[model samples]
Target: MMMRPPLVEVRGMTKRFGALTALDDVSLRLAPGAFHAILGENGAGKSTLVKCMMGYHRADAGRLLVDGQEHQVAGPRGAHHLGFGMVYQHFTLVPSMTVAENLILGRDDLPAVVAWAAERERMEAFLRRMPFRVDLDRAAGALAAGEKQKIEILKQLFLGRRVLILDEPTSVLTPDEADQILGVLRTMAREGQVTVVLITHKFREVEAFAHEVTVLRAGRRIGGGHVKDLTRGDLVAMMIPPMLAVEALTVLDDKALTAVRELSLAVGAGEILGVAGVSGNGQRELVETLAGQRSPEAGLIRVAGERYRPTRRQMRRRRVFVLPEEPLSNACVRTMTIAENLAFRNFDEPPIAVTGGFLSRRALHDRGRELIDRFKIRAAGPDASLDTLSGGNVQRTVLARELSQSPKVLVAQNPCAGLDVAATAEIRGRIMAARNAGAAVLFLSEDLDELMELADRIVVMFEGRLVYETARAAADPHVIGHSMASHL
Candidate 1:
């Protein structure tokens, strides 16, 4: 018996931008019906490699082969024509269109005449053949994040795409939803229906679903093999390090009186350090100082062992994101569209910003739609003004922006304060997920119960000082309350 040729292959692929080499001589092979995972930190060239394959970017060097034949992919359309499809981190569906309409919307042979009955019949049969089902008549915008993601995959399949590339598909999903989606994909791979290529930073997903893995670092493929052959330590060694520390930090309030005095704390990677306090116990000042709203009077802030300032550039570069107390007043611009507000974080970055510093309105709207679905924010549409959204929806918008970055250091101040029970649960789950993914979380809240439930450690804040500290396992509410009222 002869071995089968790889369904997709890249040899000596390289991409460059100006003086920077985004991808350097990277190679990949995907077997038919196989599940492959690409793991990397930000800027590790994972996106560059995929873009080259999808023809979104013309590689500076190397060859792309589909079914052992070389092909020059001109763009996404060309790639799609070659049976390749990509599900981006953002949804591409038209909100007002029904699921059936969106599924057939991309067809080159779409009919101009009446054919709803025939299309619905065809869609019904298509859903029956799949592992899951979605209501065809339902508007795409009305679907949840997990459901929207499923539609994305189903849309590709409906278009007859045999090879699927998914970029962080589970980033916005809850754990159960993530599991369900990945499980379905895994089963599909096992049944030889499609080949799946996953781009993610999650080792748990890779360990559970992927058969083969490739690790990228600094624009180069560093290590890869069968998933069973690798250990967590092996993958961690290939990646990088991260943490957050504040040493002897001091801040002053509006009267220039000391509000945070000689405060110090460290949040290790994958750890949550909760600051427990009453409303006026220096929590606001500490949060403002961390968020760059107020300058510290003294002391040092460090991220990953390097001196840090919370300038926009530094915050973005270091992956330090914040979810402040009052998102509507502090975070969003009331007059701007939801899409425009969501783009605030990456408006100047690529994909969102085309050449010559012009913003891509389509990209902004697409990203906003994605987050809106994921965060379950009830709104008219991405074009809706921020002021039109309710208080909870506004908070969800801010949560979507900050947590979506997968921050290394998350500075959250009463993130769940005004949210409903369900929304609060969602926000807390996202925060915990971020911490579990190796983020250092600095959580400041007045709710002791919330702190005890989610924090790895707790510290009491009173009169501008951390008066008491204890591991969560050993925390005593009475003791902590006493400390919060009177420094001990």
Candidate 2:
């Protein structure tokens, strides 16, 4: 038997922004009911290509074929009308509205004298049919990220979209929650209920659910193949080249409701120690304590044979740096210029400030220029406001500011949390460089694959305690997952 034509097809898709060609002669054919995955590092054309498909962007050159019929999607609404649905990384639900109300908010086909009671019953039946566990009467804001995500999927399903596009859907979910969400999507695709186009950086997600893979690099299609036909190494080689490894470290956060308890570990010089766990498992408290954002109340932290409190002055004197998660909120003053933000750590002393306590404008700009070039920060200029930069650029600025100090002990908590593949690689590369330069690095993240690749040793955190530890080479995802779930 012959295969049916692709449910969605793009021919010679090309898009350009000024001198940057975001997409060049890109073409894709997504089969009906196939869990198609688009993988690429940051600055790759994955987002661009998807935007074109969703009508959020208009291609400069190309044709989009839906069900063998050429069509131009005018905008997001038009895409929705054309049986294409997209769920963004950030939710679009209204906080005050009930899940049922949020679901039908934008729809206009409802009866003039609407029966909310009957509607609720109908929604309940529909939810039960799909076997979704969301409480329709609850406010959308009150639900967890996973439940809100399910509501988004159900809304799209209710609209009868044949193709569902999810952008980093499980980035915030726990291991168990992520598995459940992806399993549902995979089942839907396998049962011919919908076609899935997942845009993500996690190779594990692709391996777990995707059937076909398309890889892009630097705004062009680099490779494409069936999931079973390729290896994880192949995917990494195409997406992000591996970085150098790091050592082991530990910590205990006192005042724990149930989080950190008697934690003690050590990281070697020129090594990275990776801490992995499900969110809310004492990771936050540990990072806060290590970064000096919170006092440990009681617990000894030793660095290079000296007990330390990780106070700001002690950290600065010791040449230690902390790359806290969400740098925009925690590390930067958005209203300030790029140069000003870069000077935040050292403005009180020379280079940024002179002996007379006067700010050195020239020195600041000069250093900013050097770091922007060295870190490949995409900014208008040092004078540009910090808020004007993109997510990747913001991260680049953070990395440049921290690593330029030549830190002896670097504590980075989810440094690549919201970054793209390229930005993440750059940050990880700098961390490895720090390790190689005799720095003891603490690399903490929820992304297991990242830790496995960048860490020489790994430790799992459960309810604020160190439940499991192993060398990177001997680490197993299943064992780690079990530990994360508090089952070990």
Candidate 3:
């Protein structure tokens, strides 16, 4: 028997952005009609590689071979014409459009003659073949996350794409939703309809669905093999670098309307307390209360030896900082200069402002320059607008400013959410460093793998209650997942 060539292949691929080499001499191959997984930390070149494949970013070097033939794909259209399609983490559907209309988008093959009745029937028939039914006349925008994801796949299949790439497809979905979407993809692959490439951070995703796995670290391929041949530890070791850990600090959050109820836990002074739960499971409320963005309707809060509602002045005086999700909007001012954003905490005091309460530009820039260097922020200079930098750089700026204050309590919500492999590592390292320096860190994330790696102790939030608590050593994904979905 002869071996079939990969449906897609990249050889010696390299991509660079200014002085940064995002991808270097990376290569990968995907077999036809198979479910393959690309695993890496943020900045690990997974997105870069996907971009290269989608023709979003043409490689600076190397060749992209498709079906045993070398071709230079000019852009997304070319990739689409070459039988490739990608479903991003965010939905690309038009909310106003009907399911049938959305599915027909970008199609150049529609007949010149009008036949709305027949087209509707055809669309309905097409949807029937899917594992789940989606009403053709229903508004796409009104659909659930799982439905939208299925629509993405259906659109690809409708377009005759032989290769489908899903980038963190399950990031925003519940466990059951994830299972449903991926289950449909698995069925698609099993039926020899399309080759699937799952780009994700979860090991369980790969174990459950992917037949083969490829690991990338810092722009290079570190490991590749059959999923069965790799152990859970093997994947973890490849993904998580090294980190520092710390002592414990305690927190108690009693009730509210459908939020946390009597949630009391302790995180040491030099420890990372990981909070895990399906989204909307009081994690948001806990984070908000800790950040002082919202006052607890009724509960006692204690941290850094203080027992009271943490006001802005109190939080700043106590050196408590928060790295909220979507830092560009929540943690920063887009119109402001990087220097000004960095000086937000200390703008009224010395080094950033004069004793007479005058804004000192020179002092601020000097301090900003120091932090930019320390945090490896890739900005033109301290004077550059925050809007000009990438997501990772914006996050770095946020971390730089917060950590520079030498905070005693650090509250981070999905700090590494949309970052690449390198940036994620850097942020995690900074969190660990803060812990090592005696900061009590409360880390909340939907990413189980991340929580498992960095946390000294872990807890789960479900229906406004702390349902499960355990040391990191005993934090099993299966157990945590079970507790996450449980109402009791």
Candidate 4:
């Protein structure tokens, strides 16, 4: 059988950011009316590739073809005109507006005078044709994450986009919600209504919905083929490369409730083991137990095959460090100066301590200055108050302090939760750097995307127990999500 020409194709596409090559000689063919997935690790240039296709970023070198004809897209608007639209990882709907209002808000041809009645009538027809249902009259903000996402996709379709590019569309959704949305899109693709290109790192979604796959690694097209021709192992082998181990660990919350029950996992040398779950699902308690804020009722904690404790002496001796959540509240003293806070881990034992057991202010400030510069922390100086810094800067301070000693084991909880794009990338880079330097990292986060991006393996924690585990290569987001919600 002859193959249908690609609806969208890129040849030798290359994009560079001064020193870093974001996409390197990457070529992909997105088949018409097919569910195609672009899979890769966080920095594998998945988003960059799609953005280049949409003209969000102009490629330094490459050729873009639509229906076998070469064309240079002027911008996103140009791509939209050519039947291409993208749904970002974050929702774009306006909270205060009704779904109907949001659906028509982005059009270029809106009349100066309002025409709600006719627009509503047209939207009703559009919604009726869609596979999913979302109340048009309801406020967009009042809808759940899944519904909001559906609206985002619907908005594109309503705008008459025939080729849809979804960037991590289901990251915030439940397993069932994700399945429902993907299933509907799969149906749309099968029925020849739309060509779907999914940018994701989840194996389960690819196996279940995608017809063909293109895998990118470190900005290059490393591997790809029909979904049927590849296994989880094959995919994992393409993504690339553990230390902390928790065995039969049990811990209680402040109320004396068993918040953590029989949790067992491991992180090898130079590996990140991501713990995923909804908030209040013993994630906090587990981190607390590991950090020594809470004592475990039972279980063994080891470092490099030796039993370990969270005592200051033991942590220092074992070279273990922690970056707890909410650094300002849980990890730092707000009233203290940046220098003082940075000295907390080693004030008494370091060069910061003088001959008579007194802290040398100069040494402390000097060390603080070094760390501040190294971590790129934005601050007045080492003497500046900790509270005066921004959330991202405070996180930087804590990360700088913990990583200073080049720890043998690191426990981090939502290190980039509220940080901006640049800060998040910097912090994640530091964490990955530590892993590369041979630290056993136990990374805990409620963000599944964060886990999928950084972890070598992931295990879901639910109701105080780890119910599911998978290697990054073999992970099934559906299974992990079900385990997180205790649906399995």
Residue pairs clashing in model 4 are 242-267, 242-268, 242-269, 242-271, 243-267, 243-268
| TM-scores for all predictions | 0.52, 0.50, 0.50, 0.51
Tens digit per residue, CA lDDT, model 4, 1-488: 11222488899999999999999999988878989999988989999999999999999999999988999997998888778889999999999999888989867576788688988888888877888788888999899999999999999889888889999999999999999999999998888888999999999999999999999977999888999999997776565421466899999899999999998887777889999999998989899888889999999998765688889999989899999999999999989999999999999976898898799999999999999999999999999999999999999999999999999999999999989999999999999999999898999999999999999999888899988889999998888887888847
Per-residue accuracy of model 2 over 1-488 as CA lDDT, tens digit each: 11222489989999999999999998889888899999988778898999999999999999999888999888887787778888888888999999888888756365667688887877777776685777778999999988988888888877666788998888878888888988988987887778899999889999999999998877778787999999996786577422221112333445435456667666766778899988878787777777777655456776654577677788788777888888899889999999888877788877678877798899999888888999999999999999999988898898888888898888888988878888888888989998999887888899999999999789988776778999899999899988888746
Worst 10-residue lDDT window for candidate 2 reads 241-250
TM-score of model 2 (CA atoms): 0.50
lDDT of each: 0.88, 0.82, 0.82, 0.89
lDDT of 3 by residue, 163-227 (tens): 88999999989999999889878877877777899999999999999989999877888887899
- CA error at residue 453 for candidate 4, angstroms: 0.9
Ten-residue segment with the worst summed lDDT in candidate 4?
A: 1-10
Q: Which parts of model 2 have CA positions greater than 4 angstroms off? A: 1-6, 108-113, 241-488
Q: Which structure among the candidates has the greatest lDDT?
A: 4
Candidate 3 deviant stretches above 4 angstroms:
1-6, 108-115, 242-488
Write the number of the candidate with greater TM-score, choosing between 1 and 2. Answer: 1
Sort by lDDT, best first: 4, 1, 3, 2
Candidate 1 displacement at residue 436 in angstroms: 1.1
Residue 100 of model 4 has an lDDT of: 87
